[model samples]
Target chain A: MMENEVDGLDKRKAYILATVVYEYIATGEPVGSQALTQKYNLGVSSATVRNEMADLEAGGYLEQPHTSAGRVPSDAGYRTYVDALMSPEELGADERRRIRDEMRDARAQLDEIVEQSSRLLGRLAGNLAFVTKPQSDTQSFRYVQLIWIAERSGIAIIVTSLGVASQSLFELRNDLSPDDLTRLSNALNATFAGRLLRDCDDRSLTALTKSCGFGDDMAAAVRAAFIGARTQEQPGISASGAQHLLDQPEFRDVRKLRSILRILEEQRTLYDLVADAFDSPTASVKIGHELGSEELADLSLVTVPYRFGERAVGMLSILGPRRMPYARLLALASGTAETLSERLHDVEVK
Target chain B: MMENEVDGLDKRKAYILATVVYEYIATGEPVGSQALTQKYNLGVSSATVRNEMADLEAGGYLEQPHTSAGRVPSDAGYRTYVDALMSPEELGADERRRIRDEMRDARAQLDEIVEQSSRLLGRLAGNLAFVTKPQSDTQSFRYVQLIWIAERSGIAIIVTSLGVASQSLFELRNDLSPDDLTRLSNALNATFAGRLLRDCDDRSLTALTKSCGFGDDMAAAVRAAFIGARTQEQPGISASGAQHLLDQPEFRDVRKLRSILRILEEQRTLYDLVADAFDSPTASVKIGHELGSEELADLSLVTVPYRFGERAVGMLSILGPRRMPYARLLALASGTAETLSERLHDVEVK
Candidate 1:
């Protein structure tokens, strides 16, 4: 009974701290005892709330920005709220509908999909967004063909079972009839189709080359084309809406905005962050102060890993101010991740 | 004359302070008074150096991390050193040759060159490197050709007079004969050649479409293809050697690395930074504490813009700990920029 009572007190203290932070985040101003008493039905008087607020301030979660003004949530206060008080809100129907509509017939390609995802997330959340395509090894080969188009132009098309197709163009040095190229294409596809190119070692490529009975140069060219295709299968990072950072109060300093924009243009930074999220599928949120750089401590990041079929492929996320709508942002991030995985699976299944 | 003497004294003080910072950066430790006196020939004794260090500390430029430790340059000290005293040294011939070789053949295409430049800068300087591709409108029209490869595939090849090639693949649904596709390709290319796409308005596209005698569906498809191509050409951002940040003492906090990575991932952040360099081709440096963000005040960024022919195509830069070798880094950045531009012009002239 005594332990239960102590637990209740702790919970109550936590609730008060959370309330103060939440209020401050909404107003962009400090929260005071009278305002807290009037705005929230905490069943506490102004005097009681004031005493508690003082204790919270002393505990380092709340800060008096000035002696005359009320208390504002410190970085610590924001951290506590994000970790404990923020609830996961379900994605609204309209949001889900918009995402689905946007993704419909997005039959472009992996690169297009990643680029669109970034723009969509950025637009939806009014924050920076990033997406990378699924790794190529995970995309099993469905079919392959070679066709001679012009007298000197030849095209190689490889379609993954996942509905993704990659094509390359090479100039023919010698005259090869279209029918001969078709026959060679059939021979190659018969030998390699339905097998994972990623599973094919160098020996496998060599073996297939030999079985196809083509000139060594043509075989080498085909092998080069395959390798090139695989290199792009790892998916590239695409991001958008970085200008949103300028809209936030934290970035009022033009120099700060410039530094941030400089950072964003370096896509490797986004690639690393998104790649890190793949280790864990659950939506992750990083807050200011925790980010280690005092400049970034005022910002927040919410990210989730996306999947290709049963395996995780890459990550997608939103970057916004620390005072971002966490519940909505979390739901949006997770929902988008789920939808991306589902669409990718459908492609593979089809 | 009295005022000039006082100014000379201030300059001496500034020079002594800069020497201390330079030595600390070179040695990666707090600089001792004896070492400062012995190394720079400032004509001061150990006792005088100690007195100056004390004054510098009092002025908030230097600090002792611990009681028996020598003095280290604080963020303020580094800022003062960078702004007032640091004149980054010139690159040696060998260094220039090496940087030029690294940038060789990297400008074959805008996107490829940007990626290569970022990685090469990172590798050469041992710092995080960044580059952003020119805006699409800034690029002149390359020759455009569409080659039909198979039943469903075609390749769009665009070769700029500047030797940059942009390629994209298109998949066809309704069958079109190779001759007919070739005619269509020729027709479209003839209509759009030698003009900037950005200069074409909606009515122009419609007029071009009608004048080319393209069917409604084919015209729509071509428009979509053009728009899709433009989307990919939005802008390119690249960075390499992010792992280098881990080796910096300032980023000892893993959380700080995470935030920096997050900031770096946003290409818009960097695009905004480098775009400013095009305003002037001269080398520019943003030092620690000088950056607007209190969070980023501990780091420094050195950037130089590279030209394509007579026009600037992009900016290249390195990000590192504030205690960087500014002279070497500046030379590396500027040398790489000059090399990239010169080689690109060479390729064009060839």
Candidate 2:
């Protein structure tokens, strides 16, 4: 009846707990002993099943909403089910083909690829799906180019080793000619190439600019551009199918819906949530209150880091009500991340 | 209850129709004549209110869900109410100050400003909020720069007159030295500057590149860069607060939730929905079935075009259930768009 007793459940008890979780997820209702015995063909008598249900409720793995009603899995029960009895659901051929086709059609850019992944996951999982851009801090500098576009303004284009490009416009107190701009660009590439952008400090930039034999004004402009490049905003989170959460009966209460919606509005919260999943080498599941937000106490998130080359740069996730199909959603998250990573690998090569 | 007689409603009929719509919107229940008379101090008896309600129903502005129940506003009724009876809900001074502060702090880049506007509108209106990047097709080229990053790769930086910068990487069939890149960059800026990027056709690009007196390989690379710049993906749609839709009783049905979620997943659909509102000088309201998608038949959208300088290039919108407070949402959309437009103008000038 305590938290430490989760591992003490025998094989049959584990099977019963898993069945209860699965049935409640599918039917959005409590599971009774009679229904479990009748529908699952457990080879046990109704009385035996009832006794096990009582034990589960006592063990903190299940709860009965009413004295006479059936049992539902507690968060602890879901966690145990996910860790022990669950088998990753295999995707059907049509689903795989749909995912491949959508990804192939979206092979043009990083942004398009991430968006397509989010849409596909949301549709397949019937839940909110999100994909983050490969964090720039995790990427190494591939090239830097400064082009003087006006007398006092220039555009700086920074390309990461992952093939993502970003541009920013900088204004100068003094103008630089085309040759000066080219020299500055070359100096920047020489100093920062193959290094993580976040590791670029102002001191190194100033030293490099000074070493390039530039006057103070030109060096200052170069320093501003380099600093601007390093501190650019992180690649944002792209989310889709949020409306799918409304389909859950738990969200029927307006207050609950509002609280959850407010959490989703904070981009940083979502980014951190998925970013934490990168520490795990495979699919990671945070059930209900484990998500660290009281507002999300009724929800669960299943996430996997989608990689590019050897590094985990971004993550894909499926968020839903706690009574979600863990096996199926985890499988989907794993499969989609693998496919997306392969596609991104191809993009990097091209 | 025909559509043509909407304008013929007398003062008393307008008052009663407006009262019914307002009461239904606030309470999410049918408005009975007795309840309207008791709650609204309309200087009319229950019998007179009942007679007016019957006439409104006959004229198609009101509907009775059942034979004996009270009345609700039909689509036509809501439209009439928006056009004539409702006074725009002005934002209080504190709300105005909050929006202004948020915009002022978000003035660094077009993307950030648009995102801040979306978050602000979503929070204030308590609905799904979206803002689009200024469409490239609507923007003229301010500058174009081609910079060689590696032996076979280069980045093309395109700066629109609105001060938004975009970058794309292109593969080179032949290597270009610094002089060649500079010449190509100058030629591109000379040929396409001040012209709408959408007007940069392949034929024009080929002609311009050939006229630049470069070798065919070099000309082809230049042409590729120009065409790539022209076809760069449009600034994307940023959406937030989609979870708010679940708070509406109308979206309590799983089917409705799924349909709306599917629409929100399609970025092009959202872009087109708000893009249509650009023709209006101020806020535009699309109620219920007028949104052009059967999936969105139960939703309402309030949108206003956020401009860059004098040209309307992007839109801001609030998406919610049809029972939303149209006046307040419209006013919020208008105020936010105006503030965003001014902030973007300041960025462009700098």
Candidate 3:
């Protein structure tokens, strides 16, 4: 139980909490007061440190997993330390260079970028890395095409400024000849080119058909095809390096491992869990318990959005046990986002 | 330890081996002679069955996991039972109908077929179900289009009779207008339509440029774009329902789970492991030792090639514990393969 009206941490209490969290992350063991005092200069004795640890535990900064065990950082403890005590570690020069080079190689194949980014980030952070493909909700339209396939059905292709083409099969109320599809394709392209893609909605699809002197069939096909393409072409999330979790002692229990692995398999759950990455520009950490889920009480996620120009297009994130090297993993994520964004600018049309 | 030189099983011994394998799979424990006789109707006396069990153990068909424990089937035992004794179980009518209807709903879009097939098959089989995208080595080309994007580059589009389109950004040797691109696209379509897609190779790509009275730049773009699209568009394997393995006792050890999952994530390893699915027209089972890998010594794979019309276009498989119900899974695979092939024929082009 935590006291809601507790005062903020004093200087000595803050130092002890930081040292305890760091020690626990390194050893995967609860940190005792004696160990913290002996390992670092806290300017105090073990008895005095023990008293401070008890007070911190009551305030919900630390937790004793077992009655006899030493204290470890609670989720609240981790949150405060991340916000105040932890200093971001600078990534190695070689690591940052490799991220930049590999991302540049991935280039315009957005699918490859998602797969490769997860792999690189997973290996670098030594945790499960999650990446959502870079796509902007406010993308601008470049062109639209309708190709005749049969008597009344055709394929609608929409090209976006993001250098992607979304295509799907469509049906018309009346049979349209190849010449008619060609003419309609040209008219649609002229109307929507260089405009925000969201501006071309279902209403415009129907309104354009009548205004362009076409029948209701054209509107039916255009609306159906455009909506279908948008839904099917939405970018997906990739979770990589699950094997990395095998080494963590916390996941030795197969039940615990199953819950986390099950979450990884559920794409919608992962997308919702990491959706906060898109809420801000800088990297943010989500620790266990703070996520409001029982299964994920021992896990942590660090998410940062990668931008294309001024628009935040996608996210790069890492998920691991709550006892993680937060300072290092945060640095890795922010550095990767920056590198991926810079590399995207090199692609000609982006 | 196992012995290689042995004669085939006689009637009584075969019955004993089959029953033991069944009991072990269900109970997840060694099949003691006493327990087998009590649970099953072995006509002979308990002492007589025990004597046969000792003989079978000496012949290497079975082995005792511990000195004090009863016997379990060896890999060789499983092989002989699968090859000679097991009878394939028929899939339930409701299950078969579900597979057929769901596959029909996934027609036209090959990616959706792959994803949905894995999910459905994995649930039905209760194991890690793997499905490779359906594509034929001798698929016929339907049409080609070159759309101008900028001064020297455009997008290459190849539509196949499989109702699938492969597209990639391409570069040309010189600037070509929308009219020039239309002419070149027509020429290429006339040369390759309704012919085996394999007919279009690197050399033919260049030769067609000369024959069409187009510059070498056209040949350069065609070859690069076609090869790039083919490589990027190849159907990948989807390993789904990994969570289904949680109920099995064999994977209680995290090490085993890690090894198998690491294999699943490595697309190349999985592709190689199930490559034999393309070798024959029938469903085949590869037992533990038959795979010849140390990491997978306790696992088995069942592979079946799903067809389109008369040609084998893709594979459906299940990777699970060695002690599995071979008869039922084999029926499931063959049934799924037939249904997917039939559904593919509903698409007009095929």
Please report how far candidate 2 places residue A267 from its true position, in Å: 1.5
lDDT, candidate 1, A74-171, per-residue tens: 77777767766656588889889889779764654555566767777877787877776776766676555564555665656566655455555566
Better of 1 and 2 by TM-score: 2
lDDT per residue as tens, model 3, B1-350: 11232247777888898889888878889988889999999888888889999999999999998887989999989988788777768888998898888877774566666777787788788988898876544567776777777778777777776656666677767777876776777788778777767667889878987787878878888887666545544467877878777768888877888888788778878888777667777888898977778888888999999877677878899988998888888888778877867766554352
| Listed models, DockQ each | 0.03, 0.48, 0.49
Docking class of 1: incorrect
Residues A181-283 of candidate 3 have per-residue lDDT tens digits of 7788778877877776667788987888778777887888788766654554445787788889888999877777778777876677888887766778778
Task: List candidate 1 stretches off by more than 4 Å.
Answer: A1-109, A112-132, A135-227, A230-338, A344-350, B1-14, B27-35, B45-88, B92-117, B143-181, B194-203, B215-224, B231-234, B253-258, B338-350
User: What ranking emerges by TM-score with the best candidate at the front?
Assistant: 3, 2, 1
Q: Each model's fnat?
A: 0.00, 0.59, 0.31
Residue-pair clashes per candidate, as listed?
A: 17, 3, 0
Residue-level lDDT tens digits of model 2 in A1-350: 11323478977788789889989999988999998898998899989999999998999999999998999998899998888767768888887777888788885677778888888888888898898878777777777777776677776767776666656666767766867777878888877888887776677877887787766766666566656655656567778777777778877666776675566678778877776787887788999889998888878999988887788888899989999998888778777887798788655623
Candidate 3 ranges beyond 4 A from true positions: A1-7, A104-108, A345-350, B1-7, B101-108, B136-138, B232-234, B345-350
TM for every model, in the order presented, reads 0.55, 0.90, 0.94
lDDT of each residue in B217-247, candidate 1, tens digit only: 5555566555544555437677777766656
Provide chain B's TM-score, model 1. Answer: 0.76
Clashing pairs in 3: none
